[model samples]
Target: MSPRKPDADVPPGLLLVDKAPGMTSHDVVARARRVLSVRKVGHAGTLDPMATGLLILGVGAATRLLGLVGGHDKTYEATIRLGQTTVTDDREGETLTTTSAAGIDDDAVRAALAAQTGPLQQVPSSVSAVKVAGRRSYDRVRAGETVELAPRSVTVHRLEVRGITRPTPDLVDVDVTVDCTAGTYIRAIARDAGAALGVGGHLTALRRTASGPFDVTRAAPVEEAAAALAAGGGPGVLPLTEAAATVFPVRAVSTEEATALAYGQRITATGIAGPHAAVDPAGRLVALVEDAGATARVAVGFPPAS
Candidate 1:
């Protein structure tokens, strides 16, 4: 047998994927592992099988950074159906109840949605991936475990109703754009809005629009990644330094400072409060630096000569 090439020692970087609906998050990672040809692949957040849109995967050393990004804010475009309740809080679940939403005029819909725009305590869907005493809530529920998730503080930075349609007295479909914190369930938003209006609710469709600065437009499908890798071009993975420069505050370091970092030493200071990306003379992202008390050194290590 041919010797297998070693998995990359250094984390490669982030691959922004435009995940298609119908596959679990783990499935995306498995495909990425083949295309990127590295075992250190990981993703920042989970998207439901029925939801499509941007998914950010970390390659190599970038896996270490997933935890940081996972907890950041996210955005979505979702369709909420009022006048119906579902077992999973979404269209895929069995219908549990239905109430005619004919009395819910647009003015009342707007008011209820507006009330939830800022910070709110939200109860997650019972079938969520959240853990209950070490078991996945979804798993427990499927096994006949009654699930009840408590309310948590979550911020909805923005929620805009794009359009509303009521094709039947028993169904009210509202398309909305939502920018919210991580762990905020859009399904719950639909469910609660209906409950608030004495109707019923569940999410019918969902598409993640953005996560942090990453968005759907920049996401590459697994097929695209595979084609890129097949020609030896590699999966257009974003180099950490370049990715950092694109995403973080750019601090131009002097020749001396860059050299100090390249050599594992510290320069006086960039005079810039960081969590900042530092670039070399060639415009190569070298490190992410912060002022840790007295010295300015690398907080994230990007191999200097690679």
Candidate 2:
């Protein structure tokens, strides 16, 4: 690992966490702070407490990269209960209504899911984290107010019905896999699908499988991550060099060019796209650069000497 700057405290990089159920995303960050023993820690995306799976976190300097990471598409596996509606659109919320899904056939379920695939305008659930009047919609709902949220554009690239199970005449459980753009709400899809079929619906389970380039497969268990950090060992951050190369385009720079870029000087674009990583010969990240036609400008620089 490269040596930290004298003024640096904790190492800077990304940490991939496989979040456990019943833990909020902020709770994960709190645990990370305790383990890593540094105050600077931030997650790229928010995962609901009822949801579990991959969560990408940026520690120290890596925090700057989180905004870029959050925009990527995501994949999720979920269970939709096609018999009931909930205030929160998920199992965690109080049941608002119930209807028999006994007559709904596989064809009906397929047709409903098919309608939700592709581009559409979706109204997020009232009990969602979406900001309304600078307050969370969920918070407003909890305070006994009915929140009607505006519909937003979201894309569901793919929706595959994994399985269908009938535990009772009135209840149907549909397991599904979803690949969607950021800002999509799977719970809303469930709610809408059930509503369309004349049976209210809500999400029963949700597990994120992938977020951008990071997947649950590569994520460290939260407990294990904390233990590693508490032991005064590495916090399992994705190395800065690897993170930059994997998430963006790459440009190799000689030591001299790396120094120039670090010192805020522009270099010739190597025909690579703008916002590419400029790596030193030693494979360390030098900075993030953007192509300015004739010259490359520094977006963010990491001076090797520092």
Candidate 3:
């Protein structure tokens, strides 16, 4: 085997990409690596090939922050088609059933979706990226194995009906905006809501509008950003310190405290409720710290870039 390439020269930062439809989350990461010439790129979360929206890419040392970043709440705009159920719970999959939704009125749709709002147990789609028995659910499904996923606790903070339109006599398309906690599946929402109304449903479209403090509006188009990078212009990356501050509470530490934390020593309590970004006197991120009783301990530390 060839020797592994070193990523020591790659700058650590985050890139917010407005992913176009038909590209998987991994596809965007691959493109970033090629364009930015960085080998340590990874995405915080994955988006289906059929879905489009904001995708966060972490480069170099910033990859360490992705786990916490992926835990944040997310918002999405989706179009659910009532009357058709698909094997994957989305339009990309084979149609499993079709029932006329002519009798399903607007109020019925609204009420059914409203009922799905709040804390609930959600079964992820059988063809989801969720892992089962050490392999992806989708991989198992593709191998002709029946996949049954267990229900997970997820919260749907809001489900707003944007519009309801009938493209055909038997099919109704409902546009909705969902604000949900991490891991909430919008596809399952459509499926359950349609089942409640005596019809079947599947997602026709999905676009993530927001993830925590990052939004689609602030994301740069993937190709555009890549082109800029190739041309020696800005890569549109948010530097590490700024990205950390945007996602977590900020705690400015004294020079002495920064040194101690850098050496893996505990400092005084931050008084912050949760994990916070501790920045050195020079405004560089030193570590993510949380109070352990009366003292703050480093959850993750970033040694100064040499």
Best by TM-score: 3
Superposed model 1: Cα runs more than 4 Å off: 1-5, 8-11, 229-237, 254-264, 304-306
Candidate 2 stretches with Cα past 4 Å from truth are: 1-8, 226-236, 304-306
Q: Which has the higher lDDT value, candidate number 1 or candidate number 3?
A: 3
For model 1, residues 1-306, the per-residue Cα lDDT tens digits are: 999898644445677788898989999999978765678778888998989988888776667567766877899999999899999999889999989999899888878887778899998898999999999999999999899988999999999999999989767899899999998999999989988988889999999978887777877786575345434344445666666765678888877777778777876666678577878778877677887667777787566544
Q: What value does the lDDT take at residue 61 in candidate 3?
A: 81
In model 3, the Cα lDDT at residue 238 comes to 75
User: Quick one: ranking by lDDT, best first?
Assistant: 3, 2, 1
Q: Tell me the whole-model lDDT of each prediction, alpha carbons only.
A: 0.81, 0.87, 0.89
- 1-306, model 3: which lDDT tens digit per residue? 999765435557778889998999989999888776778888988899999998998877888899989989999999999999999999999999999999999999999999999999999999999999999999999999999999999999999999999999999999999999999999999999989998999999999989999888878877666555445345455778888999999999999999999999999997767999999889899999999999999999999972
lDDT, model 3: 0.89
What is the alpha-carbon RMSD of candidate 3 to the true structure? Answer: 2.0
- Best lDDT among the predictions, by candidate number: 3
Query: Who is ahead in lDDT, 2 or 3?
Result: 3
**Each prediction's TM-score against the native?**
0.89, 0.93, 0.94
